[model samples]
Target: MTQGLDQQHPQEHRDRAILETITQEGRSDYNLVELARLYIRYDNFPGARQIQQDLQAILAQWNLTVEELFTLTRAIHQQGQIYRRTKSGEDIQDWS
Candidate 1:
């Protein structure tokens, strides 16, 4: 039988504790997007309200506003990467 995450990885527990502390304090020296991704992934977990507040606080540190961020993300998804890996100037038909 597999054990729980806290039991299997003690370091993970310590890291989570540190993340919780930073989130509650609304501060992080790490990449804001990475930190925000973690919070977003656990949005339905305990202390969700605090997570939402922390996301807003972190976003304020970024140069782009919420709308601008969304717009840029949308553009990237729509336009794909700046460079293609294929030598042929045709879209790869078989994604599989």
Candidate 2:
């Protein structure tokens, strides 16, 4: 299942957190070209700047541009990664 960015997994490393936070939620397909814009929007919030820096570092490490990373993430998310859960905390697949 595609994990929502609102909850951080304890085992997730720092670089992974940055990628998930910026891309995994709250986006329009049209905004993919401007994916980095959210960093500017959230810059005033506490800890956001550090995230921006970390994202840059991750890009450098992976030798990827922002657009490339977005494409990759979008493909992964599209591949049946998203799932729904019931309010009682049951997987949707269980109800099928």
- Which numbered prediction scores highest in TM-score against the true structure? 2
- Tens-digit lDDT track of model 2 for 1-96: 222323432323543453565455534432332334443333343443445565566556557787676676567558742446679766543110
After superposing all C-alphas onto the true structure, candidate 1 shows an RMSD in angstroms of 10.4
lDDT of 1 at 48: 39
Please report, in order, the local distance difference test score of every candidate based on alpha carbons. 0.47, 0.47
Clashing pairs in model 1, backbone N/Cα/C closer than 3 A: none
Q: Native-vs-model 2 lDDT?
A: 0.47
Candidate 2 vs. true structure, TM-score: 0.40
Tens digit per residue, CA lDDT, model 1, 41-63 = 54444343444455566567655
Sliding window of 10 residues with minimal summed lDDT for model 1: 1-10
Q: Candidate 2, clashing residue pairs?
A: none
Q: What ranges in model 2 sit over 4 Å off?
A: 1-47, 82-96
